[model samples]
Target: MAGDSLFGIHGAALEVRAQRMGVLASNIANASTPGFKARDIDFKQALASLEGGQGGGIAAATKYRIPVQTSMDGNTVELSEEQTAFAENAIQYQSTLSFLNGRIGQITRALKGE
Candidate 1:
């Protein structure tokens, strides 16, 4: 209970989001690298599994992204798609952080009885 109370799903979410950002950033960085396959995290699936008591941490949620069009250089990372996913993940990360901060503030106020 102590562990859950201090962080809960938001903590896990932050970790996952950070990891996803890294994956997306790597894809963007290697967009021109031959045979580079894009990877992504299934956010909704990961959250659902965690919430349902299936504990695998963040690593279990990652998946390879399927490209709509394969390049002649054998690179699979789509720059535009990766950029979109990165931006979206960044927004979600910020939202989770804001939520965690609010939760912490609430707890602080409750402890002070004011």
Candidate 2:
């Protein structure tokens, strides 16, 4: 019952997104580095994996690769793209936090008979 406090899919989804955000940020930061094949976050695949509820096998929710063109220096991150991803991730995180807060408040009210 205690574990029920977690927002099931929402909580897990947000965590995965947050982790992805970190990876994307790192890639962007190292965009100027030589031979760096930019990393990406597989949000859709992650969500599918969560929904599929599969484990102990091939992980579908893996960030496969970046569709980067061949660069001599080998840096593939685009500033605009990374910024966009970061903005979107931030919004999603905030929205999830708001939702969890509301859920907790609802439970609190129920406990108080309010």
Candidate 3:
């Protein structure tokens, strides 16, 4: 959190978004695997934990997703839902990255006395 002051919440946000992307990707990858239960990160909770200086980070915020429709094989992944979440997370990740990039640019310009 010490470094967070440099970029505000965007730094932690980027990390959470990246982790969420992986979780969503995993869900998408295991969509056909029987008994595979989809899991996702609670972005707010994860970010809060990080900013609050608490341990556990993403793992503590990770939660099993409840399926919109149960499958006979017990696989909880819904491909469409996972895909949509992934896309949205990807967009958010990009936005966070952009914010960080802009911040870095400002720092660079300031350092150069520009």
Candidate 4:
């Protein structure tokens, strides 16, 4: 159960990060759209909900995005902010992958008795 839970948690975090990246991309893509506001996911709350027996936290985030900036023309996306957030999210995602990979390597080594 613990291993299943860890895998589930890691998968959920990965999905959330991916979706957040998509949102960030959407914001960047619609930068010229007069009324777009940038949006983001609440990772902490999403993860909590998933871990609280909610059947994977990533599902909690796939549907919608919370606006970070509201525009006069009803647009919630801001180019500069979206770009910054995207960069940061990408960095975090890479770090998460690196850590997962390291863990995998350790597991492999232990299995091989190396």
Give the best candidate by TM-score.
Answer: 3
Query: Model 2 misses residue 84 by how many Å?
Result: 1.0
lDDT, candidate 1, 1-114, per-residue tens: 235768887877887788889999999999999999998988877776666667674567888889999899889998999999899999999999999999999989999998
Candidate 4 lowest-lDDT run of ten:
56-65
Q: List, in order, the clash count of every candidate structure.
A: 0, 0, 0, 10
Distance (Å) between predicted and true CA of 73, model 2? 0.3
Clashing pairs in 1: none
By TM-score, rank the candidates, best first: 3, 1, 2, 4
Lowest lDDT 10-residue stretch of candidate 1: 50-59
lDDT for predicted candidate 4 compared with the true structure: 0.70
Put the candidates in lDDT order, highest first. Answer: 3, 1, 4, 2
> Regarding TM-score, does 1 or 2 come out ahead?
1
Clashing pairs in 4: 35-74, 35-75, 36-75, 36-76, 36-77, 37-75, 37-76, 37-77, 38-76, 38-77
Indicate which candidate wins on lDDT.
3
In angstroms, the error of model 4 at 72 is: 4.6
- The TM-score of predicted model 3 comes to 0.97
Overlapping backbone residue pairs in candidate 1 total: 0
Which residue pairs in model 3 clash with each other?
A: none
